[model samples]
Target: MTDRLPLFPLNLVLYPGLVLPLNVFEERYRRLVRDLLALPEGERRFGVVALRSGREVGELAGDPVDAVFPVGCVAEVATIRPHADGRFDVVATGATRFRLLAVDDSGPYLVGEVEAMAEPKGDDAEVMTLAVSRAFAEYQRKLTGAQGRGPVELPELPDDAVVLSYLVAAAMVLDLSDKQSLLVAEDGTVRLRAELSLLRRENALLEHIRALPAVELLRQGTAPN
Candidate 1:
């Protein structure tokens, strides 16, 4: 099914079951949030598309549509606090992913028609799940060593594969484009497989760096005149 919803172009990607805290100071977005809050609690939802290349507050100028990525996730308002200065602080939970169809430019803020993506399916799902989890652990261990941090327990994550995929992707310290790729991937297994490959690549790079001798930048201070 398709529905018209408000568009919020942001610098972050929201995965299903993930919680995002936002500060709404921009006039247009403040209006959008206020309107959504006025609706029934169950209907306080909006689309959060990654900003491909543009500012969120200032004029998008020519074509606002070009600034937003096609794929986005729906954010359901969990709790909202309106400030006396007309700003807002909100914590929203990601619900579902959607693809933007057509933009409606008449509103103060950008609005678009979107279709929700269907549930994902894949082969050897269990195998892929284990691969993602183990690879992530290896990567985390390597990353911790590089950061000079002591060993710590890995975060406990959801057992549900679907939510697990998102949690892992969200927790990863990766390039924005790489994270976007995982978000756009079709299903949990596909995302997990892709993440596993990425994690392995990162592990390799970290290992190579660890093998290199550390450079001592601070030379014994010779008495300088």
Candidate 2:
């Protein structure tokens, strides 16, 4: 399961089973996209790791990944829209996660030596997935109300713990570090439990916002987000 991949370190974390729409406006990334498109469909992919600090390699950071976490998700390009100005708009889906063993800088983009991570599963994962899904349902309802809308019924969730956890985490409004921590978590149960806690906390905040006066809530800062 170990292999080398073209690395693109972003400020945001991408979880498996989620879609990430990227604007490859930079020349380096454009090149990366071009190279990927040149490959066969099965091999049109790259590694997207979150940047823990500083900028990504595209910005020519003093070090390509001085503050980056070693775990990342693999992104398979589903669609590519090329622009006349040499920019690219690509839609990719997260396939699986990997742990970085090391990095190489000999290519135009960062090359990561990585091993596919193991996915944990069991009764604990199933229970945690249910708990997190319940909390997320409440959270979504609260968020809808905060946005001046009626309640929204949460949709049926995935039965698999790994898929459910990643879906809930990706749809929630969380900071970079928190999401990154979830991404770096090796165990599915751990990720699900953490997400349950986060969903509860965020739902509480949303409930508080729902209790505020419309004008007051609007002025409260970021509009209940």
Candidates in order have lDDT scores of 0.77, 0.77
**Model 1 C-alpha lDDT per residue in residues 18-120, reported as the tens digit of each score:** 7778888888888898899889999999988887744553556667778777888999999888899998888888899999998887888889899999757
Write down the TM-score for model 1: 0.88
**Would you give me the overall lDDT of model 1?**
0.77
* Regions more than 4 Å wrong, model 1: 54-59, 210-225
Q: Residue 134 in candidate 2 has what lDDT?
A: 81
**Count of clashes, each model:** 0, 0
**What TM-score against the true fold does each predicted structure earn?**
0.88, 0.87
Residue 44's lDDT in candidate 1: 94
